[model samples]
Target: MFPKLDPILHSELRLAVMSILAGVESAEFSYIKKQTGATSGNLSVQIDKLSAAGYISVEKGFKGKVPCTTCKITPAGLAAFENYVNSLKEYLI
Candidate 1:
């Protein structure tokens, strides 16, 4: 039997977000929006889901009077992502 994939990271946009965050210390909302080419509304919703899952941390602050949001993957997130990848291999075998 194949291992189950994480439902949270299963979405294309969410997976893409995680993949990018995995390679960086943190990323601004604009950066992720640009990289993913996702609309602000859609991306915000996904970000909320990831944050709620404790997979990522979302920080809201101001950057010289500009509202800025940054996201960072938590240790739990990295571990979950790793597990998700390992589980995916079950299908390839």
Candidate 2:
């Protein structure tokens, strides 16, 4: 039987965000936007969804007069991502 995939992490953009966050302690919104090639509007929507799901944390602040938004994966998010990958491996092997 195939393991169920995480709906929260199932999205292409959301998954990309998670993958990026998994490697770093935190990342800025602009960086994620650039890497995922998602428009600011769409990225914001997805970020909100992930934040609502408790998979990621969004922080907004100012960096030397410039507004900045940063995101980090939560422990729960990391676990979910790991499970998702392992489940995929089952199918690939």
Candidate 3:
């Protein structure tokens, strides 16, 4: 039987966000939005979901007086991502 996938990471947008963060130490909201081609409102809502799940960390601050939000994957998140990938691989076997 295939392993169950994580519902939170199952989302395309959320998975994209996690994929981006998995490769980098951190990323700015604008960068994530640009990479994912997601609208601000949609991205914000998805981000809130990830944050609420403790899958990622969101930091709000300012860059030269302009509001800025950054995201980083937590340890649990990395493990979850790895497990998610492994589960996907199981489907192919």
- lDDT per prediction? 0.97, 0.93, 0.96
Q: For model 2, give the 10-residue run with minimal summed lDDT.
A: 1-10
- Give the per-residue lDDT digits (tens) of candidate 3, residues 1-93: 678899999999999999999999999999999999999999999999999989899999999999999999999899999999999999988
RMSD of each: 0.6, 0.8, 0.6
Model 3 residue 27 lDDT score: 99
TM-scores for the candidates: 0.97, 0.95, 0.97
Q: Model 3: which residue pairs collide?
A: none
| Model 3: lDDT of residue 28 | 100
Residue-level lDDT tens digits of model 1 in 5-75? 99999999999999999999999999999999999999999999999999999999999999999999999
User: Which runs of model 2 end up more than 4 angstroms from their true locations?
Assistant: none
Among all candidates shown, the one with the greatest lDDT: 1
- Those runs of model 3 whose alpha carbons end farther than 4 Å from true positions after fitting are none
lDDT against true structure, model 2: 0.93
